[model samples]
Target chain A: MIMTVTLTILCLLLILCFVTTSIIPTPVGACASLIGGFLLLSFIYGFLGAHFAAVIQIIVYAGAIMVVFVFVVMLLNVPTQDLPKVKISLADILSILLSIPVLILVSIKILNWQAPMIDSQNVEMKDIARKMFIDYLWPFELISFLLLTALVAAITVAHKNKGSRYMLKEGSDHGR
Target chain B: MTIIFSIIVFAMVLIVGFHVAPLMTWVERRQCAFIQRRVGPNRVGIFGFTLFGLGQPIADAVKLLFKEDGNPSYVQPFFYFIAPLIPSVTGLAALMVIPFGAQDTFFGTVFSPQVLSVGAGFLLFFAMSSMSVYGVTLAGWSSNNKYSLLGGLRASAQMISYELGMGLSLIPIVLIYQTLDLQQIVYAQSHSYLFGFLPDWGIFRAPVSFFIFLITIFAETNRLPFDLAEGEAELIAGFLVEYGGMRWSLFFLGEYAMMFAFSGLISCLFLGGYSLPYLTHESLIHIVQPILGSFGSIAVFLIEFATLIVKMSIIMLIFVQVRFTVPRFRYDQLMKLGWVTILPLALINLFVTALVLGYSSFK
Candidate 1:
């Protein structure tokens, strides 16, 4: 009962933060909301017995990825004057018009949905690890290697001064 | 023993962790002064007889409390307000997972001395520490200063880059221990002997990883050598230029606190945390149980806690001394070290560790 109440409050707060982020549309504020949303979601995950998942969510998405987002946003240094004016797109109107029945249907489904009891105390993190590492090992390694290659490629592309005198020469220490 | 008792224990641990911040301020200043051949903070004390300036932190606290905290109109109110709290909160929250004592039974219930002994363990600490980047980034962006924003971005980028190497370095330790639980790792270290002689601490097992982790932590905490973002000469205190009084000091407090937490973690992982060499908990209990009777385990717990604190302090001392000993890294040099040097070194080390482990297991 207590867990339910706490999760309810947290979820509500997350929605509130998302709303605030949308309303403000300030880049830094939006970034902060993004982080805040991650934290709340992590907490909700923790309550739902996905402890490792919760921590990884924070570490990878909120901590690592959002940091890059914030970095780009900061680098861009967009002034408030340049912020996109709020406009009610026809697509938005159509989406809202299309969402009423879907929302009601989803609500009905959720109303009847039975959440599995998450015995946080008993959930075995080892199970998740074994599934990922032992069972799905190749896919995991492939994804990781793919990401690493992508990172290298991105860095290569981002070398702003490719042929400058200060260019870190290939196959050298850059005269360290 | 019970939920209520556990909460009380957690509060006690938290209080102790909080004290580390102010205490570190004193330690850093005194160490810096000694290194530079100057007397540091010897004035503030009872009856004007300075007790090696032990009262300095108290005085500094009082001054900060009284100092006018400016709320500049130029800065964004919400982000600026929220930013300072993140580092300290995250630092202290991360500290909660580290076990300081034994999982001894005392009233038919087993109790280990940590605020939370989650399975994620030190990974959770990394999670919290990673979020600390937001504090710097938000502080810079919110302060409405270009220099601050640049500093914040650079510092956070350094932090993120170093984080990859740091995570890679720890894989060897996890492989050796076969557990992510910090308590189990600490226990394993206490008992596992390397070559039937040396205590199986990470230092002996994975020296390369240890060195890599140490360097990354310095970068992570934004300390000297990796502290080009906070370089005084160029950007003039960088992101911190706009912050003042308690607000400014909170960031410092958070840094020091994280430094303290990291020191404890390093000690726990690399040194036999809370367990003295040749004096495992079992041995201690056996030796003291008869003499002290039922209180022996409790006594041992206290001793272990003290031992952990001592180890943590030693690491903190190293953290302080390094600040004065090392010169600052240039921005490009820092990046090269993190990516070109440390990342490759970490990957190679991990490969070597895996090979060695596999070979030994086969034997």
Candidate 2:
């Protein structure tokens, strides 16, 4: 009962963080909240016996990947451009009104859902490596190849540079 | 009951962490002074009795706490306020997971010295340490100062870059030890020497990992040579340009505390953690049991804890010595060091370790 209550609170906090991320006007604040949400999600994964997944989530997502995300956002200095008026519009209200029944249905499903039995209660790093490399080896290799192609494509597109544009005025701040 | 034990142990760790912040200030100052061939701050003391400047940090703390917390009207209220928190909170949180001493019974409630002990508890340090990026970035972004933002981003960027190499370096150790449990890794080191001279420590087993981890710690902690973030000369204290008084001090305190924690971590991972060079815990307990009698367990626990602290302090002193000696890395140099140099070397080290391990096992 206590464990259930704790997980419930964690899930609620996770939702709160995501909501905060979307609602916050500043880019940095949004990014921070997103990191929090990811951490909470990782914690929930940990509670669900995905120990390898939990730590990797923090290390890869919140740690390395999001740092790069924040770096790009900061480098671009887009918070000024992005900080539009955060008012609920007719489109937002209409979307919400349209989604109410779906939301309720989803909530009902979530509430009624039972957690699956975790066969491996103590999932170690080796078990994860085995599953990824040996069990689902083709999928893993295919995914890596796909990611490599994406990276190559991204570089190809980036290198084409129709015209390089500057965000901040030349005299504003010299980061370099 | 388990929860209660965890809470108590956690609180103890917090106290140690909290105290470490101020103590490190003294260590840095005194050690730097010693390196420079001068008597540093041998003045502040209780009732005018300067105890070799032991009271200096306390005096500094009092002054900082009382000074005006210059909360500028222009800064983003929430991020500015919460920015200092992430570093300190993450440092303390990381401390909770670190195994300071062996398990001991206190009032019949036997508990591990650490709060949380998982299969891969060691990685939790990186996980917590990694979150400190937000603290720097948030401080920069919310401060409404371009220079602060640049500084913050630079610092955060350095941390992120170094973290990759640091995490990669540990793979070899994990391969050699064959467990992610930090306690198990430490226990694995306690067996005996490899040959007749070499000790069975992580450093001996994986010298490349040790070197990589050392360099990355310097980068991760934002210490000198790698401390371009607060380039006292260039960025005017970096992301901390807008901060003052207690707020400014909190950043340093957090850094120092994290440094101490990392020292503890390095000792655990590389050095013979909480164990004598040659003696195991059982032997140590056996040796001391005759002298202390019924207080054997408690005595051993204190000794282990002290051993860990002593090892950490040695690292802390090295930090101070290096800070005073080395010149700060140029921004490009720092980036190059992390990426062009350390990252590839770590990868090579990882692959070599795996190949060696596989070959040895197969043979």
Candidate 3:
């Protein structure tokens, strides 16, 4: 009963932090809030016996992805004066409208769901790795391929302007 | 009872984490001085009585505490204020999973030297250490200075790049141990012997991974040779250009705390952790039992704890020595080292380790 209450409170607090991230004016503030939400969600996941998922959530989202986001924000050096003002447009309304049904569906599912008895055996890393390789092998391989393609695409786009210098040299050679 | 145990563990952590910076400052300075043939911090305390200017860290702490807390008018106040705290918090948090000594049972209560013995122990450490990038990045961005911005950018990029190598290097250890629990890893190391003489430490088993991990950690901690984040010559202390007094001291504390944590981690993973050569916990207990009687277990714990601390101090000394010995790598060179060299080397080491382990098992 105590665990249930604590988990509920944690979930509520996580939602509050998540909402605050959207509402925050400063990019740093929003990012920090998002990090907090990620940590809290990881805690919730850990409590639900998804230990590997919890660690991955923190490692991928809070650690790697957020660090990159912060890096980009710092690099761009976007002045506070240049920050885009938030406005409740049709898109915002549409997003809220779209999210409401999903929220309701999730809430209904959560309400009906019974909490499993706390198990002594924690989820191990090998189990996750085995499942990923055996059951989700195709999807995992496909995702890696997709990531590789995206990386190549990004490099190609970055190199395009630099390629003009080589093109100029080739053009002179052709004229000669 | 559990709450009381947690409080005790936290207290120990705080005491160690908070003091590491000041202690390391003295160690670094004295070590650097020895390298350069100069006297260092000898005037602060008694010459011979103070353990060769050991009191220097205390004096430095006092000076830092009383110094002016300077804040520029143009800087972003909130981010600037919170930035330094992030590194210290994360650095300290990473310590929670690291086992300092063997688990002990005393008076019907079980005590593990570490604060949190989670299933994903080292992974959690990685997660916390990665979060430290925010502190550097935010400090630079909020300072409203070009040098600070550059410093932050270098730090984020350096940390991100090296982290891949660091993570990859540990894959072999995980594969060998077949567990992520640090205590289990340490226990595993204690039991195994290489050729009946040397301890089967991770260093011996995966020397390449150890080297890669050591180098990556130097980059991760922003120490010399990889400390482009705070390159004094080029960027005027890098992301720390605008910071002064206690705020600056917080960053200093965080850096050393990270150094301490990483050293502990290196000792834990590569070294035999709390175990000495041929001095397993059971052996220690056996050795002490005749003399100490009922206090044998307690004595063994103390000895193991001291052994770990000694190992950690040795690693810390190496960190200081390397800081003085190695010249700072150029920015391109640093990136190339991490991505081009270390990453591929770590991957190869992983593959080699897997092959060796598989072949040996089959044989």
Per DockQ, the best of the predicted structures is 1
Query: Candidate 3's residue-wise lDDT over B271-301, tens digit each?
Result: 9898887667777777888998877777887
lDDT of 2 by residue, A7-39 (tens): 899999999999999887777778888998999
Please give, for residues A121-164, the per-residue lDDT of candidate 1 as tens digits: 66666788888899999999999999999999998888867566
List, for all models, the DockQ compared with the true complex: 0.60, 0.58, 0.56
Residue-by-residue lDDT tens digits, candidate 2, B1-363: 667877877888888889988888887888888888999889889997888989998888999999987878998899899999889988888877768777767657786887878756688888889987788888887788878877888977898889889999999998999888878878778778756475588999999999999999999888898988789898877888899899887888788778988998899999978877777778888899899887888888888989998998899989888899999989999999889999999999999999999999999
Cα lDDT of candidate 3 equals 0.86
- Quality of candidate 3 docking, DockQ: 0.56
How many residue pairs collide in each prediction?
0, 0, 0
Per-model TM against the reference = 0.91, 0.92, 0.91
True contacts kept of 2: 0.53
After superposition, which runs of candidate 3 have C-alpha atoms over 4 Å from their true positions? A94-102, A117-120, A143-176, B1-3, B46-49
Model 1: per-residue Cα lDDT over B1-363, one tens digit each: 378768877897779867887888998889899999999887789887788999999988899989998888999888888888888888888788778887887756777788787767788889989988788888887888867877888888998899999999999999988888888888888875756688878888889988999999999999997887778877788888789888898898788778878887898888878888756688889998999888887888889999998998898888888899999988999999999999999999999999999999999
Query: Model 3: per-residue lDDT, tens digit, A1-176?
Result: 87788788998999999999989888878888999999999998878777667888998999899888888766666666767887789998999899999999999998886656645265677777888999999999999999999999998887888747555455233211
Best by lDDT: 3
